[model samples]
Target chain A: MFKGKFVDNLPKIYGLYTGGFLLFFLAMMVAEKNGVSAKMIGILFLTFTIAIYALIGVLSRTMNVSEYYVSGREVPTVFNGMATAADWMSGASFVAMAGGIYYGGYTYMAFLVGWTGGYVLVSTLLAPYLRKFGCYTVPDFIGTRYGGNFARFCAVLVLVLASFTYVTAQINATGTIASRALGIPFGTGVWVGLISILLCSMLGGMRAVTWTQVAQYIVLIIAYLLPIFWISWRGDFGLFPHFTLGHEVARIVELEAQYGLVKNSAEAIKAAGVPAGLAYINVPHAAAPEGAMAAWKFISLAICMMVGTASLPHILMRYFTTPNVTSARRSVAWSLFFIFLLYFSAPMLATLSKIQLMDPNLKTSIIGKPIDQVMAIEWVKNWISVKQAFIADFNKDGILQLNEWFMRGDVVVLATPEVAGLPYVVSGLVAAGGMAAAMSTADGLILAMANALSHDVYYKMVDPKADVRKRLLVARLLLIVIGVAAAYIAAMRLTSILGAVAWAFDFAMSGLFFPLVLGVWWKRATKEGAIAGMLAGLISGTWYLIYVGPAFMAKTPWLGIDHLRFGIIGATVSLVAMVVVSLATKEPDAATQKMVDDIRIPSGKTVISHR
Target chain B: MATSKHEAHWNDTKGLMRITLALWFFFSIVIFMFGYQLNSVKVPLLGYPLSYYMCAQGSLAAFVILIFWSSGKQQEIDMKHGVSDAERTED
Candidate 1:
């Protein structure tokens, strides 16, 4: 039973949905085997997945404000975990993770550790307390906790800034997958992504987004695991994939010595479509800092990601859907478990796929072959035409050396099935899964941003008297508007998908992380302190990103803190400002302080006194 | 709101978090700080380089376990303190 007392057999429902999706996929594969073109299969994958999610959105459309905003807080722990995993995975995890590791090696391992480690903080420091506080949105928590609109208003701004950056990256990823799979233009692809994302979230809001995300997570995890399993079996990767993954890495290290390839460097592999040659564009921060700075940069980046996970509006919003504080705490564990399936396998996929390309003993070996022959391979040509990979005979040698192959780290997962000679159905399945990953993230993000605007701003501040329908209408309209804006930014292709995502995390980590954490733990934290901290963090982090980043290139990194890890600086400034300011000022009133103390208990009813 | 039982519950929860977070930080962060150094050690039977396994796989798995342990334990503590939602509803 949901919090609203609705009764339904969720596992049975989703089980059938997954079964139907797989059957439809098999039927499409059979169609492909008969006479259908690859292009037709691609189109079917994109359309069918989007159609299902859109149908879910339409079916779940709600007029009730509470249900629309937080799914009436009745979501079961397991389902919420699935939805949160889907929401958290985003385009960055789905498309770029395996590729990021493929090129960057151990350095990109930070993303996995950082991303999952953040959930520990979520379970312990935030989720249960936030659920007890019972806010519809993150900004709602800030506004209520600090006892004013100004603190809430600052949160709203940060939410917009962080979520917009993240949503744009998700849309950007969808565009890339769309173009590569269907041969559609990237520009056209983003708009399609926007329309599909809006179709789901614009109607039912969080209720639709939550259910849709659970379905998406299922597709994405299956899509992600299938190719890894397929290629592992083909290559005899191992009795268990994890053990063989380590062996494969050792083999790769052994081969690197044999083939004169440099170890632990993207420069060694020459990752394609990463904008090394684009003079006008800012250098996408895909290069892993190695040598003396590597360890420090890794720790700092992981810290940002860990903090960002606990702070990101869309992710934290999922916990609010749980039935109780205990469920909220329990769901974060489930969320971590679900996300781990992909994180553990991403390294395995990176290893297996690289081994496939690296080992001359394997049939799929492309390197060490003549350049002309390698270019003629079908997947290579398709990836090139889609602007995902690049190659050149730099030394005028006919042989394709390891350094000659260049590829966007974003497409490795998408391209792996075809590269390993899996069936066309696997490729179709991967594309749909990639879409589910991207669209689920986008829907959650767009809903978060719209809720910040419509719920936190319009309903709470500007028009407190607005009725349910009016408030929801405003939310729906904001979703479409924000979706289109993110699509437009994504179409520009300003930075790599992972790079933009890092920026979004830095924004969340900088501005919201401390305020939210401190709010729950420290009853003495005053209203003025939260506002000061939020502003200080927002300004400092953004300032550092622009100043040291490719935008201006005016200053060198301060204390090894680059544009990619601006959150460290912002968060440090925020912590100081908040702590100093709070001690300088009088503590919050007794009633508010009492409410804060009660939120820690995680029993009884939600603390709704702020209303 | 600041009753003795409520205060004690908060104190107990804090103790649990301190322990949980210490293990979390050790696995997910402390190991990574000495990342390259840890790469020197490899598991014998499995052949996983320790640092690589920890960074890419082990830490993530540890996090999942840590979360479930903390939450399950926290729920027990909540019940013991008579502040769990189940206890409240039963009342």
Candidate 2:
């Protein structure tokens, strides 16, 4: 009577997981009641959740190449959707995005639109077609379609550059979060997290990674929603914060009026008969570009992110797991929907966190208070002790004035529960969720880069006679090497977590966007043209970024185009190169044109293969 | 496969692509063109500046709907041209 299939048993398994999670939540609360210290609670969360992930990794370990490289290419639409969502919402999105909106306000919304809107491109322009191609890695597609080893090598080089930048950003987030939870220094925390990252992905391969990501997504989505639900309910903002959140936003605008923080911090408070005070305790880097420049940056960043989303190798790779082209399209839709659940609530989370810290009615309010008294608040005491926030009476006015008080934007999401007077258990949950976000993203990126290098460069180019086992071994070695290098770079704290991530998106879009798009849609695109585009875009973009910004320590942005939006320059130049070169050179043969035509069609057996 | 049949289906798919791009551009770009000015114009019911509300909340929801809708619509176009995977599986 109980001869149920594995797919039928899936719901039962996840149901049991949810029940176990609830019990753990209660156990933590009970342990706190029994006088367990908050530090132990945080430590318990860090170890417990990661232990579960590690266990999944260990259990899913495989030696099979099909299972390792692409999960045997049979993942259902829904699970792939969940895994893709988990893959997409990295530490930057789950933790830092709301904080970005909290401090940067409206302009940062570009990230939300750019990120989610990119799915439209994915379903229409890329994902479904990639599934039809049926390649193991992106460069595999470039090699076969563009008709040369040199073109494929260029694709791998671009993929490594983009994915490596992205992995470092994810590692930076994981390290910061590990330090916070373990009570270790940031540098130590990063290394500790790096060991766990390697342990998790090194054994599992692709199929196991896919399932582990789904489990992580569940923990992550729950960890994300509870604080927002509680905050909105406490603030009397109704259950649907999306609709009622404007009430809180209206208050923030009024608060901004009182502070006069930005030149465009909405209308002045004097118009509403409120006195404008010195805007102490304000966003330090809140100088938004003025008028026309603001609009330009907003559109440019959104365009860059959207293009990058379509071009990101890891995200595109997820589609190859879907059983067929139709599911690939459906998977993109569901992935966007799952991601929407968080991006939709970010503004409310940002507003709620901001209001809690500043509103006089809330007990957590700190600005305009006596410096010593503010320090005595338990949340302040906890965070300040950990160095997430700081305050001092620098002017000797005995008050924590604006510049004298500072908090990292990274602290906004993690500390919101404490800032709202919730139990310590909630903070632990948020940390687990943030760590999962970082881990899942880092896993995908490290694996994508390693797979491309080993499959495309090592096996296909360096040693075509290598067997599947040898190729898999080389991939594992590449994983360790890439993971270690990324961890070291991340420890340097090159930039804010969000800034680094945005630059990665810019890099991916700049180097790969035109070639991939035109190769599929425009059959005339040739090997030489693709090579020219990738080199011109990648080289020009990287040079412009370091020349104008902090990574290589230079200054002076041309036309006020900051380093983060360097994709605008790189992609534009790349498109021109590809078009001009393709027109000037020989058109591809009929066989290659027919290959492109087959990719565009929805109904097809796999047109290309990689082993 | 008939060459004319492939060309005909491509034309239909291209129409759907145009519609998707138009909406994507609207929600992500056009609405935010006059962002600073829109900050002064609050949504009467929601009480957020029109630009801020659209950027943070509305555009995301629109994106979710747009993708699902386009996916479903594309399937119909595929079925019409006899190019869908479902048709292949049945054969």
Candidate 3:
């Protein structure tokens, strides 16, 4: 699979990714070393990054339905793994993740564990079987597994709802990247991201999207690694950040003591746009409470993340592009390897940023010093001008206090290069990297929603006899519609990237997890059981979040669990509903049983016997 | 006779799945849920606290090894039972 036609094209793509990065890296360096403005560096980086991904989309252009749908199922394991990694690491993972850890502290490692562990679930439980089924989308699996249109429709409903929330996160990330990188208004920046996303996904679908994602993975990983590498070397740890980050963590703790701050706590110092009351609740450094309630919440949030990762529509669709069931499994391992390169580095980045932040040399004026005197630092001036970070003398003591310094979590990774006094081009590179992360995931998500609409709704439901061209046309149109709608939602930007992602995961884990896991593993799961389980889960999970969440968070917790962890409740309801319904009703018919058995074996492809 | 052999293979597969899934649950959920205790006992191998090492890198490494291990083991089982994808797809 790796040696023939595909292998021949590998060098050219690899060369393009590496060579183009070097070329741009040099250009940005020389421009910055000269008298070019910082804003120009940002604009240059954004333009080059978007152009490279857009070019990949153009180069892989195709009108064939199969190619548009699943890259014609010919993608090699390595490339598919790379593409999947790119798709998996969204803007949230790239930009906000480190800052999340910085702000949320040790307990927040749940996001890391949940996400990486979920890939294991994919390779072991879901990906190989789905590939064997040779289905077009998640709904196709459900529709066929249960032998009913109602089942298919329900799957489509969950797919659209979950993928749309997930896509809006990606678009929201894109807006952040554009606003930071191109120096544009966030609302207009979302449109820029939308246009770039449309270019990569609208015409070429999965085929174009996959190759573009591979390019994007390369850019994002490099963008992510270089600044961290620079920070480690500057800190005198040499180039091995992973091996030496532990020492840095110890030093940072020591520094915290020196600065009269709480040891081992990255407390939120600045509250931007958050009310004072709500701000206090967002503190990360409270003493660890070992109550059962805390333990349950921790376990529930982790489960929601893991289950949600395995069941996400766009991530699952990446497996459908692999050549065979084995490749699907292997591709998932490869995805983990690539993702680990970034995920493993994020905590270290957080520690390093924290160290830079705690440096007394960079500290504002001491007691009785004027606030204006503290504002003279270059990085302080830059960040304050942008309003992304602040160090106010809240006590009017004429001096900066430890708690007086406040910065947004999302800006930590982006601002690390600058805060560490690295070259301005490196900051630009981080912005570009953040853009790649956002766009690659957005491309995959838009395709997933469009597939559910065009394949499941339009082709299967509206026009069962539609031709390939017509189906492709419908997909393209739906991609445009969903893209714009998602962008508009992103422009609204209701929540933080991590918050939005958690909600998306909650929806996916609660509503889709049982149906997906059961469809492959259990033959007794009837269509009726599947439908009832999904709706019960969806309605209960969403209803709690919309109606009871605020009151629940503000007052007494519902059943002693917060709204962020409501997916646990939803999953429980879903599991009970599925089991009871399956027991009360007839099992799946013989054909469906055979389908389940065949998927388990992972041998010859299961033909999609259309009803 | 073939049906009985296939059933035995299926049983073996199920047993293997249970063992692997147990390990999965421990690393992914159980360890994190009870991480407070482990986090307090800081084993100094890599200069960071033991808890930080486990949280940041160790769990992820275990996940990678587990996936690779499971995939390899499943392939062996499939081949031994003569139900490998190659066998099914062969003309």
Candidate 4:
């Protein structure tokens, strides 16, 4: 079943991956032990990545063009799915998502809903249609459908904007991972991330990225799952046998009371290195309305997440890799299955960690320790390495107070190994996995950016006479430039991995989702309509986020608006614009009508016969 | 457009779409209601809040169920309508 020419190349890719992983791990170990700064190790890693990527570029000069671009399109479905999974995971999926859940409580589950549900829409609605059109890029589909150079240019604009925004987020996440795990300066980490992007994208286009992403996906999932399982085993050896019962309310309530927890003890428990317990008791100091509005906000966030996942550009492109429509559908299903494997466990682990932290005994032990000191003593020192300690005595009373900063959201995945007290090796593996997730996504976004520049703009729009070889050359050159540009942007702007990712998703939902969905499903959707809708969505959504979302939500009461609500408003505006403009414009001609007809009909002759 | 033999099958496909949409609506409502009721349920699993557990785990399980049921039903409907590739070839 695994037989393929690419399988022969597996050993080579594995060798490179493992070697790179080991080198980074050993360097980290030495730095942790010898009092070498994390910043130094990060700089070293960055320098090493750049050198390796450059070497690959020199070697690729001898390689054929097809092999560089799509790996001859001979990849097996299962392996392709794994690579696609890696691409989908991103730095945000590996680190930020878990952290968000750990910090935001049940509200963060919106991401899981949006992300997974989007796949269903892809498989059932969009994937098969796009695959049938047989395009190399997303812009290709738009160009062919609209049959105009202007249409192609608009597609390119959307593609680049979406991709550059996304690439910046990936690089930002890489910086966070490097700075936190290796103790590198964030700026230096950005430089390293840029070099890794250059190395991966500059060598062989889709061909190289696909195989590398598969390898990366395996590493990321293993890294994410292993520590959680290890911690679960350590925390309660009988936890598994009693998983069903242990997850129930009475047992949890009993555990909370046994732990002597106060109500709304999320912050306190996290500081104490105990899992959060659900104590129904009231904390008189609990902030905000403790009722329906809170629940409505949660629901609204979920809606935003579900809609946003469908609009992400890099994720949409994976459907193009398969041979035909059926494979695309099947591939999406497989992607969901692979994603569900980790997604289902994430919340459980978060809850369990929360409960462990809230235990009264652990709380007492943590009372006098500085927040950082507590984290170092209970988590970092025991599991990874305790390089230094910074404990804050906030209360002024001989005891140190534990607050929200001790449990920053981004720490969920990184702290998993430490929370469970797994071996140093596990922590090392998680780091590699996080890098893989970040790099795979970075590679995809860079490729999309390159394609938009070289194919859509240069070849298709600016000069239709551009030769194939020239187009290919431009694509490669653009890939390098975009990678560097994205890294620079990431270094200069943005903070926190998850924050950047959330902004990217919000942008996609607001600007792209409504236009794309309507363009496909609604016949009256004119090109003018689509263009106006995109612009309106981008402008209004951004304005609301910048001016309204934070200001009113933070300072004023009953405004009842946030980032998620901004997305909904943006989508609504886009829909209204599309409908109004379409009504005022002429209908599509016969040829355009034919294309729509073909999209709806599935009863045609087989395009790719198995026999 | 000329009427083709496939015209008869269109209704079936439309019916399938209706059913799928209905299933989506039904499950969404059920899951939401179930989530609301979870607050009252006292049962726990693995030291987690049971209500929270239902919100995270149980709702996801329902989503998976909705996917399978809807897709499988669509396939069956296609077969019955003689529109499926396998069914057409058999005929």
Clashing pairs in 3: A270-A406
Error (Å) of candidate 2 at residue A444 is 0.4
Interface RMSD of 1: 3.5
Task: Write the residue-wise lDDT of candidate 3 on A212-328 in tens digits.
Answer: 898899989999998899888876655788877766676656654554543222332322242221111133321233666666666677788888998898999999887777778
Worst 10 residues of 4 chain A by lDDT: A278-287
lDDT, candidate 3, equals 0.79
Candidate 3: stretches off by over 4 Å:
A1-7, A255-289, A361-373, A551-555, A609-611, B86-91
TM-score of candidate 1 against the unseen true structure: 0.94
Candidate 4, residues B3-76, lDDT tens digits: the string is 35444544564566566545543433333434444454444424544445544565555556555555565456
lDDT of each model, Cα atoms only? Answer: 0.84, 0.82, 0.79, 0.60
Candidate 3 is graded, for docking, as medium
Q: Write the per-residue lDDT of candidate 2 for residues B11-51, one digit (tens) a residue.
A: 98989999999999998888778777776777888877778
What are the per-model DockQ values?
A: 0.59, 0.57, 0.50, 0.25
Per-model RMSD to reference:
3.6, 4.7, 3.5, 6.5
Give the candidates in order of lDDT, highest first.
Answer: 1, 2, 3, 4
- Pairwise lDDT winner, candidates 1 and 4: 1
Off by over 4 Å in 4: A1-4, A7-74, A179-184, A237-292, A360-405, A549-559, A602-611, B1-37, B42-51, B64-91
For residues B1-91, what per-residue lDDT tens digits would candidate 1 score against the true structure? 5999988888899999999999988997788777767786886777777888887788888999999999999999999899888433111
Model 1 C-alpha lDDT versus the unseen true structure: 0.84
Q: What interface RMSD does every candidate have?
A: 3.5, 3.1, 3.3, 5.6
User: Which structure is stronger by TM-score: 1 or 2?
Assistant: 1
Question: Is model 1 an incorrect, acceptable, medium or high docking prediction?
Answer: medium
